[model samples]
Target: MAGRGEMPMRPARPGPPMQYRGPPPMARARVEPIDREKTCPLLLRVFTKVGGHHQNEEFAVRGKEPKDEVQIYTWKDATLRELTDLVKEVALAARKRNARLSFAFVYPDKHGRFVVKEVGSTFSYGHGRGDDAKSLAELGFQIGDYLSVAIY
Candidate 1:
């Protein structure tokens, strides 16, 4: 104890040295590869329009969907580029040299109302703007969801 105006000093405590652990386990986890041979393909309902995408109001009512429909049996691992090639097979407008294809997912919301959400886009005959590598699973595609393609 100090008798005057001097301050008291405390003893120092020792602790273990800090170590740098890399990224967390979840961050380093890898996605398992899916086997297409044994897995059955899902039926994907697609609608196409030459100019622009179909409005959400068009799909508001049941049995009133757009007239042009294409059914595709594909896996969830399918990329946008693969889907674009498949669309070109049936959609003549999408086969143009400089045509553009915009993709959107149509699904029912919490209130059972249909909603249209644009996912990605790709070019017809040339290199895409990076969206070509995005897979259906990466775009939050569901089994019952419908795909709408706008050809421009």
Candidate 2:
């Protein structure tokens, strides 16, 4: 019974309006560290179709190449059965890449010479231990350890 220029519809602005207050739902997703040599675009055409050389071969030049490098030592000299045969060649190349391996342990700095080691900034695939995989040190293989593997 209250018509005549009715302006009576303003009783609905109490509990949850004005865009629900503010700030309470942003727990994860702010990562920004991508600079793989300016974002690996085919990484120089897959290193020129794999003919770039230097695959181990004892650091190439005459080692027979193709392996890139693989000579880490430690873990208590790996119970010396010839360095425990490099854990059956790093577990048979991690079971042929079905995935399963992530190692990080190569120490040598402060001018003792020997270096190389850096991985894990978030690159997905599988197998990752401690920090990831990167290896060197042993400037000439005295056994400070190693693990320069890239077997995918």
Candidate 3:
């Protein structure tokens, strides 16, 4: 028996040296450097609240996790009317059949308080009322804003 305190004797000859069968494994993918000058488009987190007939079904499937209920979307070069349309489209796609959908754009004021504004169903051809005429960039919204959707 070999003891831990002493080295054990072995055969004087060593087995054949192991040889690699193929070329060296491929190198790992290189990480691309980020461009600091480039900035991301204004993005908003949306939380959908299910209601009416499909409310039970949606809740059953999605549970109550906020991450499962939230969606992130980018709105760039979009007017208020266009943004409303996009939000409506998303709501329609996500809601149950025959469900009515509404949008609320949630933003913060200069005092760091949140303000929610309801989006109208109809869209005007030209520039809209108030901040509707301005592009997203003109609205002074940075990335990571939020918009909540209500399904009825």
lDDT of 2 by residue, 1-152 (tens): 45899876666767855666588886643334444455532200001001122232332232342343444423221212322234335445434434323223233457654343422221123334323332222112233234343323
Model 3 Cα lDDT, one tens digit per residue, 1-152: 67989888886778897887898787743334434357454546666655522122222222342442445455544555565455555555433444444555555557665655555322322234434544444444446555555656
Those runs of model 2 whose alpha carbons end farther than 4 Å from true positions after fitting are 1-31, 35-92, 96-99, 105-108, 115-152
Q: What is the TM-score of each candidate against the true structure?
A: 0.77, 0.22, 0.38
Judge candidate 2 at residue 143 and give its lDDT. Answer: 38
| Winner on lDDT (1 vs 3) | 1
TM-score of 3: 0.38
lDDT of each: 0.90, 0.32, 0.49
Error of 1 at 70 (Å): 0.3
Error of 3 at 15 (Å): 99
Query: On TM-score, who's better, 1 or 3?
Result: 1
**Which residue pairs collide, candidate 3?**
none
Model 1 pairs in collision: none
Order of all candidates by TM-score, from best down to worst? 1, 3, 2
